[model samples]
Target: MVMQTDTVLQKMSEDDFMAVFTLGRKLGQGRFGTVFLSVEKSTGREYACKLIEKRKLVTCEDVRDLRREIQIMRHLNANPNVASIRDAYEDSKAVYIVMEFCSGGELFDGIKERGCYTEKEAAKLVRTIVAVVQGFHSLGVMHRDLKPENFLFLHHQEDSPLKIIDFGSSTFFLPGESFRDVVGSPYYVAPEVLQKHYGPEVDIWSAGVILYVLLSGVPPFWAKTEKEIYQEVLHGDLDFSSEPWPVISESAKDLMRRMLDKNPATRIATGEVLSHPWVRINGIAPDKLINS
Candidate 1:
């Protein structure tokens, strides 16, 4: 997928694209796009169509990112954990990206409802996310934004596998390539990202933050404002002396500590994070992965 670069515009030239799908309820909204639950009139199949207006792209980089996201999603759709793009159609004003419709809601909403999870449960969730990260890394793509909201379950089943979504913030990068963009949710951002120099390790850091939030109903660094939260992140002041902290296994905390290290160079890589003892306890490993 990394070696292949397809033209997004080439696949979106169907003149009657809008006539093929009947839009239903809105699923979500973003800076430049609106997702809706739509059905293809020809096949009567359900899909999620993200419609992005060209006029609202803000910058030329936004258009580049849109194309990059389309290419990445199209090429990387072979993995079960990834959300696949079924088709893309463009009109003069906007582009419509039709994707697999995921019925289950965001992983963050689940966390909020549960308030927290046991080590076993949290390990299972983290393993799924790490597996997706590994898959993306193997494709030479880095998900600049890795948060619970970006993870959605396929169904309401208890054992439903999580599907990683929203690649607008993702980009192609070699193993050691450094990215200067300060992208990602503030609460989950790595320290090096704040310093304006980082690589794939930033995703690992975000995974660690998510792990912390999953095991305990609170983030490692939180404050009233985004600026204050970022300051705490840069300071790297982690607290594990509280109630639930005393109950979590040392191995889990150790993994989080390694992932959330201030220096990106020393932080755990996605491969190692997948192999960590905490992540492997859920019966997910290199040989037997959830989404290989």
Candidate 2:
């Protein structure tokens, strides 16, 4: 399924990526790519280089999606909360994208290590996530996939800055525009996305799911199968009557309810979510930890 070398060069750069930077240990891997810790030859500065194999791009659509992702990353390069793309290069075999290296691991791993967080801590995290969503929407982009795994800390410090990664499923949109693609992780996917008609508000729903998981250590909608999970997401009620719920702050729950609203129109927007008392800085969310 490998594309012709000339064709790939037409879409990407013909220059040698290895000549400028040396690839180090493997950082991670995806369907069509492997991310490596790379160092620039001249400066010795470190970066993450995502090397997408041309052979795995089996179809024209796959190639288009990769290009779109690169463009989107470049578009949001100025945002401090986003992983900045430093450069892109391609050879006959692969496309290499150099980006900011996040030393700390995924937000999911961080949460797993901590077991659970206080309402205030969760609120602080959610505020950062929502701010990213708000910024993306302001720039006319919709982050079709918003999940904890896509968020990473800049360093291992407790107060390290959070940055959003993976724009592969993101796309630009106009005000009032609707997208029909059903793109997102199963647990975080909005009900409207399952129905095949949705907009940027889908990101809010996913963020709500993340918030819920952060406070409770589990997703609000859970089932043994993906189909059943979607059913729960579509019809199940929010379980504020559970164990941890009794101890969690009501202000946090109120914001959750509004953000996870099934109706996109009625769902709280990023601006309003940021302004919510529980989410705003020094707001009402308590510092007490929830039961693990």
Candidate 3:
């Protein structure tokens, strides 16, 4: 029987989640939702259960978008850069999405734990990320939000693969259509996206921002407000002056400049980005973009 849900369940009340799924600790929570760590009853495999509150849906568009996120996930099943949804269900309290469990947590957490990455290490990470985005482009899904928080490692390992999670901000496009939604993390959002003229190129722009943050240990802009951030991103205010930085090469900078180009049409091609001098190296262990 479906349990009454008016009273929100504390993650500790494992019974609220039911024994059907092994609900573990709270991974994350926000204004719209909370995600619990859980394991599937059938497979005995761990997974992340993202719970978005239904009462929080103030707009029809939000409901449409929530449905879109599920549709997009289904459409992108095996894509390397996408998080796989094992199951989905909705109750009076929330919409529950079960996904592959990534114990290593967000890439931002890793970066915070360990200062930053070397240029070579940063380059390898960026390359793996680009490959994942390339796969997304092929699937017609746009992960408008591509910040460090959205990138997660599968588990704790000397070398763990990064998994791109959080599709709530994703948008899908049919052939020859332009997406007009203003979505994404402000710091990593492209100028075109802020201006509402972006396409898939915006994903590459966000990826460049990820590269910049991974190597520099700080975002390009340190603004305190939304407007200031857009201004900085539009003007390309990126400079590596921090002490530990490895004096990033002009080639890498060139790639970044191209990816973060204010003009969407002028942005660098995703397929070609993999061959960029900074990304073409070998020897470092290759990390898969998606776990499953």
Candidate 4:
């Protein structure tokens, strides 16, 4: 049944989600909800179900944000790199979003278990990530959070495709649109975001931070606390004089510098990032082991 709200169409079913799918195990939990491994009763297919409690949505803004998230996910349903929503069911007390289940685990975990990382591998991953950013920006959406944890491999295989899994902080945007809300993870958030005014460039900065961590195994801006992390993000220097960075190719460093530029005006655009020599498909990023 369709529940029409003022902001967006809530294509939510009033029936019980358990009637169609059986919840198996807890996958993860957040402020307002929990994700569970679920199995469809008819097909025996598995899925990740996000159950959001209506009671947790105490404020109107909270409800609006949840609706907006669903709308954005529906809007980006066609992108292969993003996790697709399978079905949405809402009852009196909660909303259940059934999504494509990713069993390969988080990107960083995959990287760590591999025991070896190279610039070529890093470039390939960054290419996919930047491509996702480019697709989102072209489609007028901005992913406020772009961190390593949000990317999960499709299966438990060496060659599994990476898929982005969160849209909680994402929103639609027009060209030159500036958002004032400071909404994002501290380590991956852009300096402009902390200042309360930002555009899609924030995504590039976050992706750049991820690339930095991928290469060096540490964040460019590190601090003991969230406040300190923000301070470092706003005022800290990009460290390339350290261990693995010394062996990393100059081209990769160049892309990082451009993407992490403090001035949003000078920050690399999504298209430019994909086209960069290091990030481009089969570009010049060396195959030498970065963590060696």
In model 4, residue pairs whose N, Cα or C atoms come closer than 3 Å (at least 3 residues apart or on different chains), thus clashing, are none
lDDT per prediction?
A: 0.81, 0.89, 0.74, 0.89
The superposed Cα distance between candidate 3 and the true structure at residue 198, in angstroms, equals 1.4
Tens-digit lDDT track of model 3 for 1-292: 2234432322223334455687789989865778998887877878899887777776766677777887888888877556788767655566677888888878867655555345676777788888988888788877888888888888778588888888888887765677777888888888887777767888898898888776566677658899988888877555755533335566667777787677877778887788877677773322322110
In the range 97-186, model 1's lDDT, one tens digit per residue, is 999988888886655555444566777788888888888888899898998888988876777778888999999999778888888899
lDDT of 2 by residue, 77-186 (tens): 99999999998898877889999999989997876677766888889999999999999989999898899989998888888899998888999999888888888999
Candidate 3, residue 233: the lDDT equals 80
Q: Is candidate 1 or candidate 4 better by TM-score?
A: 4
RMSD in angstroms, candidate 2? 1.6
Instruction: Give lDDT for model 2.
Output: 0.89
lDDT of 3: 0.74
Q: Which of 2 and 3 is ahead in TM-score?
A: 2
Worst 10 residues of 2 by lDDT: 2-11
Of 1 and 2, the candidate ranking higher by TM-score: 2
Q: What is the per-residue lDDT of model 4 for residues 1-292, given as tens digits with 9 covering 90 to 100?
A: 2233422225547567889999999999877779999999999999999998776787777888888888889899999999999978887667888999999999999988888989999999999999999999999999999999999999989999999988999999999888999988989999999999899999999999999999888999999999999999999999989897777889999999998999999999988888888878889999887764
Error of 3 at 72 (Å): 1.0
- Rank by TM-score, highest first: 4, 2, 1, 3
